[model samples]
Target: MKIKRSAATIIGEVSALILTFLTHWVVFYFIIINSFKTRAEAARLSLAFPKKWQIIENYSYILSYGDGLFFRSMWNSIRLTIISIVILVLVASMTGYIMQRRQGKFSKISNKLILAGLIVPPSVISTYWILSQLGVVGTLAGLTLVEVATMFPFSVMIYKGYMATIPRDIDAAAIIDGCSASRLYFQIIFPILKPITATIVILRSVVVYNDFANPLYYMSGARNSTIQLFVYTFQSAFLTQWNYLFAAIVLISLPPFILYLILNKRILEGVTAGAVKG
Candidate 1:
């Protein structure tokens, strides 16, 4: 039996939706409104729209810095995100499977260590010390390693949860068929892990792509700057050009944000699955 919608319920639902829409758009409005004005015009009022749209001018100014390093920084971010995600998937999948399937006292201790990484603040001092000792400061490899170490625990935890959900029968079947562990994982199990993989890709790619602090401490020089570090530099320049800054900010943030909108459902499922199994 279908129940008819009440007028009060419909009104309340519409009101709630309107409130949500306005709340979401208010900041968007601020940025989009300011993104059009000249520096003088943008500062005229906190909430004012541009009297004339200088969007192109602002973009030109932001992009004109140092022969267009903005594009190069984007390239760096893409490379870092891809490499880090691939490494995390491969290493974490195998490690999580082992830890979950081969449960033992030592595995429990190892699990605790991984959890410690999550609970504790990343040890800047220890990282700096390691960098100093290895003489790898200000290098791309150094920055990459730092990112992997800092981000590894989250991926491991997620993968461990997922490994729990995968049946041990799959492993046993592959073994009975004379398949090696590595072959079984990559050819069979890895394929089955796609849903969680999508989740990891969306979630971790955004984070590693957007992380600024790690790059600030580790990748200081211009030669190896990721997009996040590059964006920070744009923000802190002497002039504080609001229009150009917002334009660059929008450009910097567009890719990951677009990706989120597209794959948000899958990402949500991955997170939910991880939480449920974990």
Candidate 2:
């Protein structure tokens, strides 16, 4: 049997979609238009097209400014994101597998703790103090740890939920094949975890790459800055240059946008699979 939507329902859905598109496009329009304007024109923050287009000049200046600090910051963000994602994926996947396969008091306690991690906000002061004690407060390594720790709980939950849909017979068969625990997971189970892993990688990469607050709070003392922090350099007490800022914003936004465009199909598939299975 085929069910058709009424005219009223179709109109409502269309109206909602148009409203959503306009809402997002308005903000994107402001950023793009201002990016092409002169500093004075951008400062006005008008929605009109630029009176004097300075797109090339603005982009060139932004790229060349501060001895190429923008690119350096981009590199820093890339390094952080890469390291953090690798560590998060490995540790979270393994932990989730263990928590799901092993049923015990310890697992129960761990589940509660993981749930607490999701509910509770991180304590900046305590985290900084711990990093200070470890003598890594101002280093990239420490910031990477922070990102992994903060994102771990959510990733674990996602993996654990997906893992529940897997049968124990697979594990039994792997063990019967004389596979070591490590080999069983690494060779067999991990490969099967591709769908959920893809979802985690895509979603968490965006968060870690674009993170602003954590870098500001934890990495403020560091000499190197992430892309988000680098963009803040455009602001000053005397005057704020909106054109240069918008130009930098556009440039910095490209990497993640391109990444999404390339992997959008995989990302959507992974998410849908996780949703259905989990």
Candidate 3:
């Protein structure tokens, strides 16, 4: 009876997993299917093969010749993601270290502030206040600042958790060896933080890369659009020409997609290490 029950449970779990895989396959299949056609095919034969099979033409049209602003969006997204994620990782590392190591009233308050920032949606009060003050409405710098502020808490929490597992003895030893705080971290603790750092890097990059609302609010011009914002406009505008839109999507999605694909192993390792150690 116990053996039968165990088998039943295993079968149920397998069935659920299979269902999830099928769903994912269907979604990706449609996305790929749309990328190889013109607007006519996308509208008329969404589920069928392309009329001309002009995958290159579809791709190039969006990129170079088509009525699309894909390349500009691609550049904007890449630049914003790289800059924002790098700053978040570095600043969050230092802030996380201090928050954990200091252990004072102020540190506790600061930690709570970060958590509050995370808990409250950025769209609520902060946007109103920031826009009212900094006059950063619809500017790249404003958007970058907001992104950093909103994303910092997650990185800090991850870093702090990972740092907790690291021995204070290491810090003491480094300090006794005449290592300054900056040198100690940059040399000793920083190296050990590789896994969580990679995890944060990939995670934050993905978030910033995929962001739409923030860009929509803060970025306007076709010349100044990020990938997500650009894709959004194209989707809204092109009711008929979906092939070019899909191709634009495919291009815009390549960077973060490629970055995660290449760094996936490191990202997993970092997350696993942080989890187990924390």
On TM-score, the candidate that comes out on top is 2
- Greater lDDT among 1 and 3 belongs to 1
Clashing pairs in 1: none
lDDT (Cα) of model 3: 0.80
Candidate 2 lDDT (Cα, whole model)? 0.90
**Candidate 3: lDDT of 81?**
84
| Candidate 1 per-residue C-alpha lDDT over 88-195 given as tens digits, one digit per residue, 9 for 90 to 100 | 888887787788888789899989999998999987878988997899887766777887888788888888898788888989999999999789988998887788
**Which RMSD does model 3 reach against the true structure?**
3.1
Model 2 misplacement above 4 A: 236-238, 276-278
RMSD values, in order shown:
2.6, 1.7, 3.1
- Per-residue lDDT of candidate 2, residues 1-278 (tens digit): 98999999999999999998889888888899999999999999999998899989999998988888888899999999999999999999999999999999999999999999999999999999999999988789999999999999999988888888889999999999899999999999999888778778889999999999889988863356899998888888988999999999999989888877877777766666656554
Root-mean-square deviation of candidate 2: 1.7
Determine which window of 10 residues in candidate 2 has minimal summed lDDT: 269-278
- The whole-model lDDT of each prediction reads 0.81, 0.90, 0.80
Per-model TM-score versus the true fold: 0.89, 0.94, 0.89
Cα lDDT of model 3 by residue, 1-278, tens digit:
35456888999999999998779876677778988877777876456777678798887776764255677777788888888988898899988888888888998799889889789776745685776588876777777887898899888989988888898999899889999988998988888888888899888888999998888777688878888766665565436467776777777777877888888888877776667554
